[model samples]
Target: MWHLSRHCSGKHHFHAIALVTIHEPWGADRVGTSMSSHIEFRKLAAELDGPAFLPGEPGYDAECATYNLLTPLRPAIAVGAATVGDVRAAVRFAGDHKLAVAVRGGGHMQPYTAEGAVLITLDRLADVTVDGGRRTARVTGGARWEEVIDAASKEGLAPMSGSSTTVGAIGYVLGGGQSPIFGRPYGYASDHVTSFDIVTADGVLRTVSAGAEPELFAALRGGKGNFGVVTAMEIELFPVTSVLAGGIYFPGSATGEVLRAWRDWAATLPEQATTSVAVQRLPPVEELPEPLRGAHVVHLRYAYLGPAETGLELLAPMRAAAPALIDTIAEAPYKTAAVLHNDPVGAMPYQDRSLGLAGLPDKALDKLAELLGPGTPIPLTSVELRALGGALDRPPATPDSVPSRGLPFQFFGFAVGGDDLDELGRRLDRLFTAMRPWADPKHRRMLNFLSPEEALDPQSLREVYGAENYDRLLAVKRRFDPNTMFRMNHTLR
Candidate 1:
């Protein structure tokens, strides 16, 4: 067991922790403090021993490499927190030193300067422990959706996570997890979260849950990382041993026809099914293989909990609507669902914005078709629209935590595999702005999918969180994070 206490090495006032059993990097360090300021830091390192990466350390580059693939991010400090005690030391040191402490999970944030503050990397803490009987797992801040799914799958369960499971668990849940699948029947992934072991701005390790810190718990669900450093999170598991999951790809010739059919058919689908469409162009990578190598395809992915016979019955109309060049849709497990969206696993430039459309009206489809049809200037890989509502409309548990989700569809306009960040961002703005007319007034942009450029612009937040919820968030900031340490995740301040 690791015991957290206090110590001082010169002026540094870090938490002193002692560990009895664990790995070496995670064992107590009793020989590193030379000064009083660093004494506390050393003690804590000993208590909950883990790798402490100071400036010029060997693993520093890899630890801070979270945002290295895309955004221009440079942090004065990057500590690969080994344990909860390590997190406590870092928090205390930052608080005492009065440094802007920005915590990073996967560092997927565009620009990586949401609020222009000091950054902390937590990528090394990816440990997922599952309890099958209870159907729960304590996920690390660095844990990704893929890790959670793979682990839970071992126990014949799944967590409500995003399409790109590589997105950090804490960061995604805090921003309100809206996974591509499972949301229809199970609700958002946030609702399944049991608790959070967080290190707040004041350096106190607190556990927030439904019965524990209710208000903070409520706010933290969709609040993003505006309160503290979430070291670990306890989330519920879902039972899904197998599923009918795969993707349907339509050639560029059927854009208008296919979209119209999809728009019409999607309106009639039952809650047992979860499906979405993407208008995309496959990258010209030799390793990719076949028809998708260098062609524009309208991809449709479907996930049905029932058998193939029934799933085929439901998908008949969509299948009949268009002639697919690639029809890989078939019976598969949750493990195979990754092929449905063909999400980029190896990191590259990822920039996009999410839209909550009232519904895929004919006018909106026509607009999207016209803009992205065959010869469009927007070098986009995929423009997607996820089906929302059902459990999504109702708050998981805390009724007031999630603002009423009014829109029926959550749209994502994304461009990938390019280093041109500025160009990609501008293209997204054009698409979102063009969609303004059909986009719902109550439709809040999924903050996680928004571009950094759009992080500002006062009029936008009015549309996203709504004027009232936005005000509530501001009040939350005023109360809990007035100093703005947690404001690094796209804050207007």
Candidate 2:
């Protein structure tokens, strides 16, 4: 029997799992500390084909860097797994030594690094293969969406990937990715996963799909990385060559007007048309276009998989709703759709939170504007509400646990750090609290959006998967990971 923690913070009750004690890598110069009493390090290193970096070893710093700059990762040892066998060896070694383990795909997830833990960096596992005839793309665990898009485009097909091409393909899909435009028509990126090649806690490789290991397959779809390390996955591709997509920016003065109009207009949009309204405070950076740099504006991101003329007609109402300062919306190859949201590419300190809503009533919009509009007390960078409906409301034949399926809109807010982490935290707390009244309880956090700090909270996991799904996830977790060895990202335990 699993005894739950009586003091589980935020209502997270799980089996009592032993915490791995932190110790310097045995091979590194111990200074005063000694590895004289432990197992030989070279013997373990020799078992794996990939390079293993001990603390203070060369390449350790570079390999451990996470995409979220705010996370400070200090793993006792890091391994760059090149083959399936290498991964197996690493997990087995960790289990034998009672060391905790964590896996990275492009190092973009909430950094799960801790002392005495084995960090498996999958940067070398990146291999994208597109089968044009089958209209499917086989993406490795570490492959980024840009590579997936570039490869799929060559075959005249496109993937239902996230807004930023830099995000890891497998990680995004597994965590329930919400693509800006394609979501309305095809549902989420996870819906298109053909299969997954995962390495479980017991060091066995398993191929999961709808027909095989169906329960585990459903859990993997939106279960995050709780069950195992996903080495590779095959995703279904769509027949899309070009799209009418980009952003339309209105001057800061028009933020209120544009948002109100956008909310009302987006409610009536067809499934083919997907849009999001954002209030942005762009930094004065040279990388950004002149119109967006150092500007506070209302930007509407649009993506429509239709003829250019028809897309324009559909968007006509929005164009006339407010006087625009800049309009980049145009017909372009689907590969260029990345520009619609224009997410930042480089690493920076950021605090992010999201909520779901059945509908954005006038009261909610008024509250949102008060909280995130220009000259607000909060130092927020952007607040966006993406419209969700149409195909997104329909579940796949073989269901997965993606959240917010029937919700009409999703509200996301971000506070980028500017030398003050404490202030950023405080501001974000106030921002979310002020807008809680309109937040739907049924809406939960998507795993991809979870920060390292947030992922550690079991209550957050319960919120992400919900009560019924959370209980079911626990059952699946016990089946594959009886000891909870894979308790790294958004852990079930």
Query: Which one wins on TM-score?
Result: 2
User: What C-alpha lDDT values do all the predictions have?
Assistant: 0.67, 0.76
Report how far off residue 260 is in candidate 1 (Å): 0.8
Which residue window of length 10 is worst by lDDT in model 1?
Answer: 12-21
> Could you tell me the lDDT of residue 472 within candidate 1?
72
What's the TM for model 2?
Answer: 0.91
For candidate 2, give the lDDT of residue 155: 94
Error of 2 at 156 (Å): 0.5
Residue pair clashes in candidate 2:
none
Q: What's the lDDT of the predicted structure labeled candidate 2? A: 0.76
Best by lDDT: 2
